[model samples]
Target chain A: MNERYSRQTLFPAIGEEGQKKIRKKHVLIIGAGALGSGNAEVMTRAGIGKLTIVDRDYVEESNLQRQQLYTEEDVFEKMPKAAVAEKRLRAINSETDIAAVITDATPDRLEELVQTVDLIIDSTDNFETRMAINDISQKYQIPWIYGACVGSYGMSLTIIPGMTPCLHCLLKKIPIQGMTCDTGGIIAPAVQMVIAHQTAEALKILVEDWDAIRTTFTSFDLWGNQYTNIKIAKAKDDGCLSCGEARTYPFLQNENLMKTTVLCGRDTVQVRPPAKQQLDLARLSEQMQASGYQIKGNPYLISVEMKPQRIVVFNDGRALIHGTKDLSQAKAIYNRLLG
Target chain B: MNKLLFFAHLKDEAGAETLSIDVSGKTIAELKTIVSEQHGLTKIDSVMTAINEEFAEDDDIIQQGDTIAFIPPVSGG
Candidate 1:
C-alpha cells in the first residue's frame, strides 16, 4: 500500500498482488541468532503483517562477525538477542507488529507459538529444536523452511506438509551427531548463503507462489565452489515418525529434550530449572549487589560477572553459563548463583 | 568404475571434492563402507548419500560410471 514495498512489488514474480498477500502473512522465526536476525529484518521490511521471534541467548562479541541485528552496545549491556531484535525491528518498521520472545524454544513453547502463525522458519543451532519444529510442522500441516550452516557450508530445504518429504524422512536413517561451528568454525558468507535461500522460499510461500517453491533440498560449499540440489520429493516415507502414515511425532514429547545442554558453537551451557519459576530481576540484582557481585541488567534479565565465567539469569528460571562448555561446571555455577 | 563426490566437511575428510574409484558393481551401502574406510570418514556410516543428485536409498545399486556424493549435516548458526 505504501511506497515501502514498491521495489518488491515491481518484481515480475511477485507483483502488487503478491505484495498484498505477503502483507497479510505472519511468520514465526525460531532462534534470533544470525539466521533469525536476517529473516526478521527482511520480513519486517517486506511488510509482513506480523513476526514472532524466539531466542534464548544474548549477544556476544563472537557473534558480531555474522549476526547483523545486534550491536556492541547490546553486548556491553548483556541484552538478550530477542530483546534487542524487538527493539531494532520496531525501529526499522514501526508498522509491522513484532513479538520477540526471550525464552527457550522447547517443543511445548514452539507448539504454542505455531498455533497463530502462518509459517515457521528454522534458524536454530541444534537438531533437538529442529526436530521438534519438524514434527510440529508435520503435525500442524504448516510450511517451514529448514536452514543450517557451519564452517563454509550451508544448506536449506522447504518442507510443505502433505506435498513434500519432511526433514525426519530426509535424515531418518542417518545418525545426526555432527559438526558445529565451535568445532569447525564458520564464516559470515556461509550464514548469508542460507539466509538468501531461506528468505526466497519464505517470500514464495507467504505470497502463495507454490509453483515457484523449490522442490529440491539445496546444499553448497562456498569455499569449495560446490553446489547441488537434490530432488527428494520421492524420498517421502510412509513410515516416517514425524510425517508418515503411522505418525508418532516423537520429538513433540517433553522427555526427548534435556534441561541442561551445551549450546551450539557458543562455548556456553544452558541450565533451566525443572519447573518454571517467576524470577524477580530487581530483587535478584539487589541481592547480588549486596553479596558484592558485579551486576548489570535490564528488566528482563541480569548478568553477574565471574572470573573466567559469566552467568546470565532470565526471568523464566534459565541461566546461560558463558566461557565453558562443561555441562557440570555450568550446572554448578547455575546452582550457586540462582539458588 | 564410479565417480565419487564429497560436500562440506566430507570433502575435507575425503581429501578431495571428487574421486574416481573402481567399484564395478557395488550397492550404495557397500560403497559407503569402502569410501568410509578409504577416506577415514568416521561419520560416513551416519552421513546421507546421494547418487547422481538423488538421495540414495539403502537398497539402491551403484551402476557403473554413476556419480556419488556423501553429505554430512552441519548444525551451527
Candidate 2:
C-alpha cells in the first residue's frame, strides 16, 4: 500500500485492482495548453504508469494564466511546453514514467505514437489536428477523449473507435468560421472545468469502467449557465466523408487545406490552406474592427493589425499571420480568422 | 407534426430542450425551412439536418413519424 495512491485506491471501484491497472497503462496526451497541462497533472497524480506528452509550442508569459506546468522562469527560457511539463511532472510524481515529445504531432508521427499507447487524449485547439487524431484513433482502435475551453465555456467528447460514432459522425460540417480564445478572451476556470471532465472520463476508461463512460458530446458554459449532451446512437451515414465511408480526409496532409510556416527571428508564422471557398470580406472586415482589431483589405487579402501581431487574410479565407512562433498560436490565429 | 432535436452549441443557442412543429411536409428540405424559421437560425443551406436518424438529402422525403434533427457545423471532439 504505497502512500502515493492510497487515497485513490481506497475507492471501492478503483480499490487495489484499479490501482494496478493504472500502473500498467500508457496514455498519450497531445497538446500541452490549458487542458493538456491540467490533464497531465491530474492523470499523473492518479498514478497513470506512463504519460507521453506531445506539444509544439514553447512556454510564453501568457500561458501562466491556465497552463499548469510552467512558471515565469520556464517562459523566459523559451522552454518547449512538453519539456517543461515533463520536468514538473517528475517532481509531482517521481514514481510515474513521463515522456515529453517536443515536436508537432503530425500524421506520419501519429502512427508511431498511436501504435505504442493504449489510449489518446486530445487537448488541441484547432479542428484540422483533431480530425487527424480522430482518424488515427479509429484506424488503431484506441479510444480518445477530446476537450476544449474558451471564455466561460468548454466541451468534452469521448471517441471509442468502432463502438461509437467518430468525431466526424457528430460534426458533419466544420464551420471555418467562429471565435477562438485568443480572439474572445478565455477565463482560467473554464479550462479547469473542461480538463476535470476529460480527466474523469480518462480515469473511467483507464480503470476499465467502460459501461460508465460518456458516449455523447458534453458541453457547459459556467458563466453563461448552459450544459447539454446530444444522443448519437443514430447509424453512421453512408455519405459521411470520414468515419462513415472510412474516408480519411487527413486535412493538412492534403493540399486542399492551407499550410503554415513559422518565420525565424520575427516570431511569426504563415499558413497557406487552399482558399477554394469564397467569403464576404466586407462583413468580415466589419466584424474584425468590432472585435478590436484594425482592418485593412483590398481584393487579394485583408490585413488585421491587432497590436504586437499582424494577420494578413486572403479572399479564400487563407491567412499569413505575423505573431507567435507556436503551432497552437498559429492555429489559434487561423481559428480566429475562420471564425 | 413531429419533434425537432438539437445538439451541443446549437442546443444551447436554441434555449429549449426540443421544439415541436405542426406542419405536413413530405420532404426534408421543407422541414429544414420550418425548423430554421422557428429556431431563428441563419439558414438551412449551411446547416445539416437528419431525418429519421439519417443524414437527409435535399430531395429526401420526410415521413409523418420520423424524428428530425438540426445539426450545426460541429466544433466538438
Candidate 3:
C-alpha cells in the first residue's frame, strides 16, 4: 500500500483494518475524461489495490484544462485517455495495479468487463452510456457510482444494487437531450467537487463501511453556491424498463449500430441491418430513387449511391452515414429509422 | 396552490431556493404559462418541469397542493 494513505488510514473509521480492505478491492472506472482523471488519481493515492481505467478517446489540448491526468506532452502524443491516465497513476502509486483498456463500452463489451470488477464508477459524457451502465450494474448486482458535470456545477449518486434506488429510480426517464460540456462549457472546480464526492463514496465502499456510504443523490454548484440532496431510497419502479423488470436490454444487441468509414474525399452515408431483418429492398430503392441513388452489392453488404450522399450497410446491422460531421446526429438518425 | 422546489440552474434563475404557485384544476402546460408570465420565462426549452420530484409531462394535470419544480440541466459526478 502507498505510504500516502497513512494519514487517511489514521482516521478511526478507516484505520489499518479498513486500509487493508481498501488495498484489496478492485475498482473499475469507465470514461477517462475530466471526472475519470480526478477519480483515478484520488483512488490510486488512497491505495485501492487494483485499478482498471477504460476510455475510448485520445487526449487533446482541450482536455488539459480539467482532465488532471494528461499533460501537454500526452496531448501532443495523442495518447488514449485510459492509457495516459494509467501512466500517470502508475507514477502516483505503483502499489496499485493499473490496467488501461482503450475501447467504447457497448453492450457486448460490458458483459466481459463487468464480470472482472467488484464495482463500477461512471464517468461517461452521454446519458445513453450512463443508462447502459446503470442497467448492467443492476443486472449484475454490482455497485456503481454515477458522476457528471457541466458549466460550474456537478452531481453524484451512489447506487448500491440492492440497497438504494438505482439511477432510473431517481430520474423517471432520460431528459430530452441535456446539454454537455462541449455545448455548455464546464469549469475545473465543478469537476473536482463531484469527483471528490465520488471518490469519498468509493472509499467508503472500498473500506466496506456500508454504513458510511451516502444514500441520497447529491448535487452542488461551485460558482452558484448551491447544494442539494435528492433522496432516492425508494424501490425500483415497476415501470422502469431496465431496473423494474430486471430486463437486460443489451445496447449492442440493437440492430442500428453501424461500422462505417468516410471515403478519402467523398461525402455519403451508409446503413445496414442484421441478416434476419428484411431490408425491404423495393421500398428502400423506391426511397433512394428520388434522390438519384443507385443500390449496389448483394444482401450481405448493401451499397447505396446518391448524388453526393453515400451510405453502406452490412448484414450484421452495421452502417456508415457519410456527409455529416456530427456523430450524435448520425446515431440519432440510425436509432430513429432502424432501431 | 402548490410548492415548487428548484435545483441547480433552475434555482439560480428563479433567484429563490424554493417558492410556491397557485393553480387549481390546471394542466402542467397551462401552469407553465402562468409561471412564465410571472417569472418572464418566455423561452422554456432549457428547463424540465417535474411534479413531486418526478418529471411531469406537458399534458399532465397539476392539482393544488402538488409539488412542482423546474429543473435545469445539471452536471455532476
Candidate 4:
C-alpha cells in the first residue's frame, strides 16, 4: 500500500485487503459540478485505480463557492471543468489514471464509457442525465449512486440493478414545476452533506462491501432539522420501464433524449442537435465574423458575442446559449444562427 | 390528526415543513385537495405522496397519526 493511503488502510473496514480492492477499481463520474467535483476529490484521495471525469461546462466565478476542486485561476482562464478537475486530481494522486472527457453525457457516449468503468456516480443537475444514468446502470447490470441537493435538503439512493429499486421506481417522472438550484438556490453545507453520503457509498461499492451499502432512499433538511430514511428496497417495481423484466431502457432510446435543455442555475440553455450532424467550427466562425459577430475560439469550441446573449458552440453540434433559460427561445436562436 | 410533511420546494409552497390536519378516513387524493386549498398550492397534483416513508397511491387511505410526506422532484447536484 502507498504511504499516502496509510491512514485509510488503518481503518478496519478498508484495511490492507479492502484497500487492494479499491486500488483496482474504476469509477466514472458524470458531471463536474458541485457533487461531481467533491466526489472526484474524495475518490481520488481514497486511491481509486482510474477515474473518468466528464463535464460540458467551463469554470465560472460563481462556481468557486461550492465546487472545491477549482480555484480563482481556473475561473479566470475559463478552463473546461473536466480538464481542470483532471489536473487537480492527478496532482492529488498521480498513481490513479485520470481521463477528462470534455463532452455531454449522451446515451451513446455513456454506453461506450460504461463498458470500461466498474461503477458510476450521478452528480448531474438535470433529470434527463439522471434518467440516462439509470438506464445505463440497469442495462449493463452495473451499480450506481444517485445524489442530489438543493436549498437545505439533500436526497440519495443506491441502485444495484436487480437488487434495489432504481430512480424511476422512486419518482415516476420529474415534476413539471420542480424547483432547480437556479430558481430555488442552494447552500454549500447541503452540497457537502449529499456528497459525503455519495462518496461513502462509492467507497463501499469499490471495496466490494455489498452488505454495508445503504438500501433505503435517504434525505435530510439541515435548516429544517429533519431526516428520513425510507425503505426503498421493496420499491423496486418488477414492471418498471427501466429496470423491469423486459428492460425497455426508454431513456437510452434515441427518441426519448432531449435535443435542447434549459440549464439549471445558469440562465443558459443547451442545444444538442442530432448526432449525425458534425459541426464545422472554422466555417461557422468565418460566417459569424462576416456577419459582424466578434468570435473567439480554439479547435474544440467557438464563442460568438451577440450583444446581451453569447452563444458558445462545440464541435459535437451542441450550443450553450447564454442569457436565457427558455427552451423555445433557445431553439429559435440555435435555428437562426447555426442552421 | 394526520401529520403532513413537505420536503424541498414543497416546504416552500406550504410555508411550513409540517402541518397537523384533523382528518380521518380520507384518501390521499382527498387529502391533497384539502391541503392544496388550505395552503394555496397550485401544483398539488404533482407532489408525490408517501405514507410512513413508503410511497402510497392516491387511493391509499390516510389514518390518524399517519405521517404523509408530499415530495416534489429535486434535480440539484
Candidate 4 residues lying further than 4 Å off, grouped into runs, are A261-307, A310-339
- Tens digit per residue, CA lDDT, model 3, B15-48: 7767876775788788777767776443344455
What tens digits encode model 4's per-residue C-alpha lDDT throughout A152-198?
88888888887888988777764333445644568999999999999
Would you list the rank order by TM-score, best first? 1, 2, 4, 3
Worst window of 10 by summed lDDT in candidate 4 chain A:
A174-183
TM-score of model 4 (CA atoms) = 0.81
Q: Score the docking of each candidate (DockQ).
A: 0.44, 0.20, 0.23, 0.45
**Winner on lDDT (1 vs 2):** 1
| lDDT of candidate 1 over A63-102, digit per residue (tens) | 8889989999999998999999999999999989999998
lDDT of 2 by residue, A146-166 (tens): 887666767787888767777
Give candidate 2 regions above 4 Å deviation: A238-241, A245-253, A261-270, A306-308, A322-332, B1-77
Residue A123 lDDT in candidate 2:
82
Stronger candidate by DockQ (2 vs 3):
3
Q: List clashing residue pairs in candidate 4.
A: A182-A265
Worst 10-residue lDDT window, candidate 3 chain B: B40-49
lDDT of 3 by residue, A1-339 (tens): 346777987798999998988888889998898999998999898888899887777887978899998899998998888988998899999899998998877666777888867888888775556777888887788899989887787788898876777776655444432445644568999998988899889988887899999876676777868776655554346666566665544333454233334435655444333233434444344444433457777656556653244556555556676666444445434432232
Candidate 2 clash pair list: A177-A338, A177-A339, A178-A339, A258-A272, A258-A273, A259-A272
Give the total clashing residue pairs for model 2: 6
